[model samples]
Target: MEQTVQPCPQCGTEIRTDRRFTTWCSACDWNVDPVEPDERPGHVERMRRGIAHRYGERLLAEMTRGESPRPRRDVAGVLAYAVALCVHGVTVALFVTGALLVTLGRGGAPSVLGAFLLGLAWLFRPRFGRLPDDAPVLHRADAPRLFALIDEVAACAPTSGVHAVAVTAEANASVSTYGVRQRRLLTLGLGLWEITTPQERVALLGHELGHFAHGDTRHGVIIANALHSLNSWRYLVAPIRNPSGLEVILNAFYLLPFLAVQGVMMLLDQLTLRAAQRAEYLADATSATAASTEAAVALQDRLLVCGPAEALLLRESNARQVRGAAKRDEPGQGLWDRLAAYVESIPEGEYERRRRVGVLRGHSVDATHPPTHLRRACLLARPAEPAAVRVDAAAVAAITAELADARQVVARCVLRG
Candidate 1:
């Protein structure tokens, strides 16, 4: 017997039912007024066609922009290290040297030193990889299943194979965009693991592929670090000048000059972030293209709702604990804040805030990612998509692509394990 599709309550037409409790009849083009419920196959088909057509234009736009270039593994590594190094290097180099610059009243050494320090702190600040380190990092040779999916995404757009694909847990994932060479790094977090089916995972990966297609996979990282750098000079300087103890007293005496410099850097930071927001939208569009609109939507839905409330809360708490542990291990700190010149020099306001946000928001320095709800809604709006049951087309292409050479290089690293 043929299955009877449910019709919309507002109009008599075939429509897929949803757990969300929202129903509409696409066949009648949605009624101007509510209708009595009825079961009709013809009505169902018509409604289905209507809804499909209604969303079809939007969905197509989202899916066609698939494929992302993989970040070069070395480049990704460099960024991760460089950002951190930039912060430390400039802080020490500038601050120690800045004293002389300040003394000489050199043509703009103070400004130059301030600018460098700002950029350094910005690049190295913590960010939300929310995905854990323990998550599986799929190498080209290892995880044929996952590699096949990536290949398909690349075919939809020009791309080098991803440097890595990881699951933060059973449920969620993130793709890396920054670095020198083309590299895409995926992190599938625990939340993603818990709520989604394997089919959904492929769909989710497709969204990351979308980022590749739109060229959003890498540009923003540089931008984000740059903005942070712009702001951090204020952070680096305020601490050097004020030493944090009594802001009120300092505010009365030196507030004008402090605010003057801070205001300029703030403007620069704002300008940089404004540009970053536009880039984020491009990445979102990429998510829509490589995967089915529905799958993309569902994958995000699964991520937001999957993890327990406690896990979310605990994550931040745990992040704090981890930072404290790291600090204790460092050679200079000596398990105490004895007011060293360097420590005192780093604007105290930015220091603790950066640490807190790392654990709290996931990104230590810049909270660039959009909120969970907005991200989920954007993905969900694309509803109805092709399944992730197949990846053969992509796999074949990957085997022959130029990236095959790159894969071999990464393969050597994986082989060591």
Candidate 2:
């Protein structure tokens, strides 16, 4: 079968393709594939009504034959979606008006103004740019054992399978989809991978893979694109800094209308985006389902401890590397050991203190994930289970061996960043 070449959904690196179940990225090791939504009881109906409710339906009932009753409306989220739709509608209206004005004006002041408006519209048109591919994309051919681990994780997950896998430099693990097709991509940060135990790593992968269960990222991408469009429009129309008096006055005329539309869109986007916190909790449950409640909680605990510790070490390492005290080809084993030691050096009470304080002073309104404390609370409340995922020693060794080149890739990316 011929393969479709596309950017990795997670990191936006171009994928290397062949006849296989999925597209692969050697630059980041992402298994990219589009997984269809499972038949959730009334899910499609619920989503359809959610869209309908956004467009001014008050009484919730199925208009079509054999459809379920409308689900409880999410007023804020629906309103946000509506606002985004309005922005799109308004943008199209502006384009049409501008084109008509330009045609009718025929080299008059109206023509000049219309041409300028058209230029501005072009400048602010919705463009969903790809992310920088700073990680190493991988394939099953590159690491069959590691790919097997992903398969095992997928089997345990509610989702079908992982599409692509990649390795990044951050002390984090995440999953994302790219392009209009919603191809899924999984990214594992080498910093997190190097320090975590095999079981914890499985737990981490489970947490990320768990996102597919709820189909969270699918809608998230839509909301994100809406916000991106609004932001672009806002910036394009915004007045230049320190403008002359007349320029400022002229800019005010241009910006006021753009700001008015963008303001509502921004508000709605925040409301809808904030509601994604529930998805975070659900995804966390999926992780527990794949691994165990204990493993999930332990993973969270480890992240809370290691996140800050990793940052501290990262700064130190970068400084040493900059000063030429560190070697580029020096394997990551020493770096991993130093990270472990750094975490160990912290007092037990200090770890507790950090965990208790939460990761941030307070959660940002735009934060997708719930507070760390809230996540821990939920995990602690869940019923415990023995670790469901077993560590494959040979697989682990092979994965580690394969990542030797990845370490270098990550190092260069990190330093460049």
Candidate 3:
């Protein structure tokens, strides 16, 4: 077969051979859309005139050139934090004032009003909901080998340190902070680990730790808490349904403040969360640096395999359990082996088509990360040498040893469900 490369009509970047038929440009995320034709004259002009701030414009341009532009402090993030603090203050004040009235108002209308305000304030009080700290914890002492790898990664990251690690049934990994002091915790999903090669595991770890380096994960925590508080306030102040005319008037009055606060918070989320998409690119670059570019790209490719592969495993696990195979008792035995076999069986053409679809997905308001294709392009444009970190076989064995029981429990729980 003859391979041809041509410049993208839109961006003038050389389009790779594999993407020629798709007419996709990784540099600009431009693709020929059969569904939305360029014959619409006004479309190009409208896109050219799209409203964006100077910072956003510059950042996007850098991304197009496969560069990792440093993120700026978000005005919306700062304002949202201020709003959250004010809400907390107001709730506390109302609670204190209402308590005084209830204590001294001598059982009149004032006392009744005081009781109502107190209840409303209690409902609105800032709730930094508890994390699952009690979930299967792997202390550093218990898994020194895992901790060593984490420490090495942390050295390359901007975070001070990783304080705790949790293993879960999820096929994902994340870093989070918990409690008032905001101690950092790293949660590793056993399912992802079981399927990934050792180097690919490094890429996964690097990407997650990169979020901490960029402060993206911690900011998400703040945003989540702010949204939670806003929701609580909205629930407290929501208007009564099927009300009389006077009640309608009173309800509207009560609901207005909550409505305004929630609206502003939501707007701020929209403005600030676009930064998160860039953060993901930077995180991927970090992975490419810490692990080899090959490993980083391979890890992403493996992730694409996960959806179909997991479905196959799920079915097999179900069948085995139904046959009374005692899959729970057989820890080193079931789904992982079946998943490897299933993935190995996938046809090359089918895999490539699925991979193309995975990479060509367009950006949306709700998407937190750049398309995987863009990420791959960025890394290829500026390749990095793999970090000189390798886990000894003994260390790998010990880490897996520590998580053995937890993996079995998680596998059984997932299969049972």
Candidate 4:
């Protein structure tokens, strides 16, 4: 791999850059964000992004000015809950009706109809969250030190303890409830986890656990299941394209129900959007509280560069394959080490340029989250807080050792993809 040194266009600093990746000045960040945002979102997506941007800006302003109100169940929330209740009520009614028909109906036709209704009821049943079957699951016994760290962050977050941890190959981390009992589960993405410092790890945990502490309605069983049911309905009734004669008539018949389902889903999304955004802000505050303001902000900075990190991984995988060096038995060998080194090599100027790009693009972890810039601003706007949970080098080392096997598994998965 040959690297050429050249003077930066923006500044006279000489820098070395690999030809495979973007060539940018490390000192002046020249051409760091040369690519323009090319995604052209649809109308609904544009509207959603618009709403999020406005809300994020307003919230950031309010927080900075110390005028933000404590989140509570507002009209939208009440309406959302009522809609979710109605959704569940319909499912329950269908079940009851189907059961009665099946038990009491004397004729075969009635029994068949009842069975059909029962199937519909089953289709619309509330979905309890489940852990991904493929991801490596880590129990308390498997990773006591990691769980202990999570527990410490949980205490600092003042949230309920997580029941399990799952590791995946994504550049993100999240917490969600799973199963009938709704036990909390934390998903740690090695892409993000490997790059984070120990304190940033605490910030990551605190942010995830904060969803529980703040009672994020979007993740709550009621609203989540309702959204799931509505989505199922939408999928079930959606009209197909390129229909033949008979299918055309059926498609026309299905159109009304599809439209109705879409309307309901949109209404539910509108109701929950505000609450979800507020929850993110609150969660970020929790991250700051647990890991200190500086670490939380740094975590946001890391998030801004996740795109590049992922691209680097993809490039590495492709390059290895091209060189015929991607061994089956040792797939993704040294992948994590390479990724960590790449992240460490990113210059501060590069980080700053990415932050500015984030602001320009209203970049967020997802559509549900506020812009990364706003999140960072909100954290900086507040008074700096000391870390409530700390992780020393020994703790990090122990956690790393605990996740060593899972890391290998996830690394292989990433490379294989």
Candidate 5:
């Protein structure tokens, strides 16, 4: 609650700061990146990060040069699709072989073996995404206002709108296709949603829906299923821990298949890596287009603080647990309200530090996304534009009211965790 002033160590510029937050020189960006780069990533992760950095830089340059960010049908894209097709082909072959053996063997030993093969086929079958059973599902009828906002964002992205919304306790949001019909579903994480402003919420929706508009092959049923099958294969053939003599011999037999699967998986990842980065950049642009460049860039800034928000939630949950359920259910102390306050309380200097850290460490939302700094840069590279879809105070209130019940459910889930 007190302000302090001192000369910056890096530069003798007078710096005014709050005691509650980090003190850094605004003039020279002294101590802008306070955190050290994490050294925990393995060799594979390091390699992937390197690739992401390279791709992000190149794509940013291209976009700055006035090139449209369209998905390229280049050699890597073609090869990746071919590999995905081959992966699916193996699944089909297994089914066909099992069926032939069962039909021709006439209930003999061959038929029994055929049944085993069929079981294996079923085990490795392509998986269509499914809605989480535990998550709170909000249908259009249940949340018309929220769905309307989502539809507005989807229309701005020019993609198919989501069929349903699923509320979760995580600090991230994502869109995916689910079930045999490939219906679009938007997973709205209350942790992130509650902290974002109305405009930033639109930007978040825009970025996710942009994946569909941008033709991100990784999210498609074909490639997604291929990746799933490969992961399953990898899990099956993985080396065992503390193996018995007989198990050691079996592991020796499994080693070749394990190496082969890993090789294929790496190949697929390498082939699609550039395209995935491109899709993310494109999605960021869509976010800017739908919610204005300022809103989109601000959304990225908000993302930098998600770690702190989650930490606050964890700390609150632990304290509440110590106080027992009676204290947790006390009125006027809603989890969402606390989360919003904590996020709003984050200092501007802290955000700048995180932004600089992201630039230094190549920070990303995940392995699949481009570095956040680059995404922010890409949005700012273009001229700032007005939002295509704006959420006024009335609309925000309506949407918030619609999500009230879901918020309580997610709040309980977080506290229980």
Candidate 6:
């Protein structure tokens, strides 16, 4: 189905999506973007009541119903399904050598193996491929700012390395892959710096470091890589045979095994995702405990508005930029052509669910973070604590330091590789 990018209900501007995640809107005071959320709580008082302990209890209970209650999905659903599909596909083939002999040729076995390997390669692309070498590293002068901020927070958090950081307006931060020792990345968007009060920004960083502190960052990356690899193997043939033009056909084939796995990895991924989500909650609480309630609330407000606004701005900006090229549906196209394009756009239920979670909740559950609204709800509902999230005099100094420490080592390596 062709989804007409709708206009933002709030701002009446068009909605847009790219790269499957929300970014920023330049027009509003709130950084706008999209994901999903419960219909607004009507008014502040009602929200306060609905999100109160009694409501939280009721909401929590309902939310947990039919949920694992005691499920474990360290690998998440898709990845687990991918793994199962791989095993079962191999087993079935082994059992029926006759079918293989009759239906396919010598290359079949190698093809399967090659597909699996391709999936595996993409899964760990970071480890083998040059790291996103272009990922911004804080400059030397900025290093003190980032480090000092990290260190101050590290007093509460364990050591977290600064492997890479970039500029985006997603209100996002991340920790890097796992090894003997853990390195981290802190991506700060331009909007994050421009709009947020220094204290709130620090609190946001603390929330990120808290993820590293809890060890969720490293674990999540492992699971994410595994999931990507499995998908690679399952969808290997389609990419080569038809590319994305027949993406729907490809994805259906890809999802067949996940359905059979009956949600093995789904449970695993949820557990990990919830862990990360809770960590953020604690981080928010930590920031509140460390700093002021205002900073906490400020962060939440900014985050809540970020998705919808970004979506709006993206549409407006791109409209002017790409108006001439917008594909008008051609009625004369054959079914195959229509099917090819439409299928590419439609994602599995799981992906759709994830998108809704981000839109409504600002989270893809398996992801380490949740949207700003849920966080604000949790924080505001609970008792308040005080910490500054640490916007020190050093923030100005950090500007220079973050810039000074930048490098291009990985970008160069990827070119050579």
- Off by more than 4 A, model 4: 1-39, 67-70, 319-326, 331-333, 363-365
* Top model number, TM-score: 5
Cα displacement (angstroms), candidate 4, residue 168, comes to 1.1
Task: For candidate 6, write residues 1-417 as lDDT tens digits.
Answer: 323455555566665434343433223312342433456444533533333424333433433342321223355434544554454454345435544443454667755655554444434343322234445545324465666666666555444445556544332445454343444556665433434566767667766666565545324545555445444434443333455758767667656664543344444344344444545565665565555666777666555434433443344335434654353332211222322233234334323333334454322232345455555566666655567445657685655345432322322221222
Q: Which stretches of candidate 1 lie over 4 Å from their true place?
A: 1-136, 166-172, 177-182, 217-221, 238-284, 307-417
**What are the lDDT scores of the predictions, listed in order?**
0.45, 0.63, 0.66, 0.83, 0.85, 0.47
Model 5, span 113-208: residue lDDT tens: 888888878988988888889999988999999898888888877887889999987789988988999988999887898899899999999999
Off by more than 4 A, model 5 = 1-39, 106-108, 242-244, 331-333, 363-365
Candidate 5 shows a clash count of 0
TM-score of each: 0.44, 0.71, 0.73, 0.88, 0.91, 0.52
Our tally of clashes for model 3 stands at 0
lDDT of 1 by residue, 1-417 (tens): 122357666666676533222233445534322333265436534543344333333433443344232322334334443443454455456555545655565657675775564455445453433323443455766666557666766665445557675543222455664344435676655334324444455566666655555454234454344345436555544634435667656655555655755664444333333223334444544444555556556555444333332243344335546666553323322111221222223332223222232233322122234434444444554444454344455553553352333333332222222
Alpha carbon lDDT at 327, candidate 3: 47
Off by over 4 Å in 3: 1-60, 64-69, 102-135, 217-221, 234-262, 324-328, 344-351, 358-360
Candidate 2 versus the native: TM-score?
Answer: 0.71
Off by over 4 Å in 2: 1-73, 94-131, 217-219, 239-244, 325-328, 364-367, 412-417
User: Could you give candidate 3's per-residue lDDT for residues 1-417 as a string of tens digits?
Assistant: 124578978889986554223445656656533334335435423332232223334444586575544555767657656765665677788899899899999999889989998997877665443456445777678777788888776666544557778876556688877667777778887657667888888888888888878767225655666566667777767788899999889797988786787675556455555566667767776777777778888877776566665576577667766967554566543656665665655544334554566444333212455555556666666645576456668878887787776666666666665
Ranking by TM-score: 5, 4, 3, 2, 6, 1
Q: What TM-score would candidate 6 get against the native?
A: 0.52
Worst 10-residue lDDT window, candidate 4: 324-333
Candidate 5: minimum summed lDDT over ten consecutive residues — where? 324-333
| lDDT: worst 10-residue window of model 1 | 333-342
TM-score for model 3? 0.73
